[model samples]
Target: MGKEKTKIRLRGHHLFCSNVMDVDGDPIYSARFCANFRKYQQMMADPSQAIEVVCTCGDTCRYCPSWNEQDGKCRLYDYPPNANRIDLEMLEALSLSVGDEITSGELKQRIKGRFGTTLPAMCSWACGFESVLHCSQGQRKL
Candidate 1:
């Protein structure tokens, strides 16, 4: 018998934020949306590999009214119409493929440059977090 290779699935938002490490230096998500993404980030250095993607909504979808629990997908998947466009553009800008390996710093810098804000700010805005850390601190205007 051969060992089974685990397939890593990534949602659109993972491209923007890396996993946050806990006190013990363990990575954790603020929500339940990105198990495979977190794992993929941990395992792969180049993110160009083929990956299954569900949506770009990210962790903020937890509180979104349009989140379709039954399907485990986003109701607003095409709401912005350009949602996929943005995701593709972001991937292209970062030079990342579905499973291509990349450094966290490099990904963050690419995201910051493309979005004109910090990753936390981007996550906050995407997830609709009430307190946007960067904006609140006046670090970088979003």
Candidate 2:
């Protein structure tokens, strides 16, 4: 059988998660969001390394130019970091370094289970919201 291709869907401009605390040796929020950064560029130099992210919104992600024209649903905005569809090969490689090997996925979930920054996601959402072609002035909550 041919190798199965992985598809990574990145709807937002950037990815982020809460940081883990250092005291309990919890996964840092920055570390979680930036796990790929920890993998070192050499490891991800290959376009095949990838990760799957669920965008709260579909491909119409407010940021894409095609959003309004296509009713917030379009393929142009959905793709792996390399512009290719999701590729499991890329994710497997990234997991080796960024994510710990767990037969059932990482056992240690929730970075310290502590939420430090509530504004980051809001900031990100606001940014994407504004990028929408039809957003009204002063309509942004942030």
Candidate 3:
């Protein structure tokens, strides 16, 4: 009998941000968040590792400082509205839907082919979106 491996679930926007952002040396996040993210990064070091796309609060969110177990959502997002907004944009830009399975390498190629190294950052907040994404919508994120 063959055993099947469970796919790693990652938030949609994380597909991009994870490449540029590092939780190490950052004190803003909870230890659990850092640990989980680091583990994800380590796993991504493998080219064959598959990542499941998700736009909602996911595994990483479980360790996020803003995550409230009782509410089962990030406090920064109202039932996933604000957070979903960012993730939805990433999915729309990539022309992908939730549940799509992709390797980080393939996704990176797609991003390069589509945006040519940078995607427009539409984040309205000072969340450092500029570091990884450029703003196409100018000052606001829709």
Local distance difference test scores for all models: 0.46, 0.29, 0.65
True-vs-predicted CA distance for residue 136, candidate 1, Å? 13
Local error of candidate 2 at residue 94 (angstroms): 26
Q: Write model 2 residue lDDT over 55-130, tens digit each, in one string.
A: 3322213343334444344444334343422222223322332222222122112211222223233334323432
What lDDT score goes with residue 91 in model 3? 82
Q: Which candidate is the best by TM-score?
A: 3
Give lDDT for model 3: 0.65
lDDT ranking from best candidate downward: 3, 1, 2
lDDT by residue for model 3 (1-142), tens = 8776556787767776565455665444667777787787777767667889875666666677777778555566535346577677778887788999988678766666666644447444416545333333221221
Rank candidates, TM-score, best first: 3, 1, 2
Worst 10 residues of 2 by lDDT: 17-26
- Count of residue pairs whose backbone atoms collide, per candidate: 13, 18, 3
Off by over 4 Å in 2: 15-28, 36-142
- Model 3 off-target regions past 4 Å? 1-3, 78-83, 123-126, 129-142
Q: Which one wins on lDDT? A: 3
Which ten-residue region of model 1 has the weakest summed lDDT?
Answer: 20-29
For residues 1-142, could you state the per-residue lDDT of candidate 1 as single tens digits? 9765444454555455433321122223333434433455555344443344344454334434566666556664534555555456456666666445454445545656666634443344354432432233332422
Instruction: Say which prediction, candidate 1 or candidate 3, comes out ahead on lDDT.
Output: 3
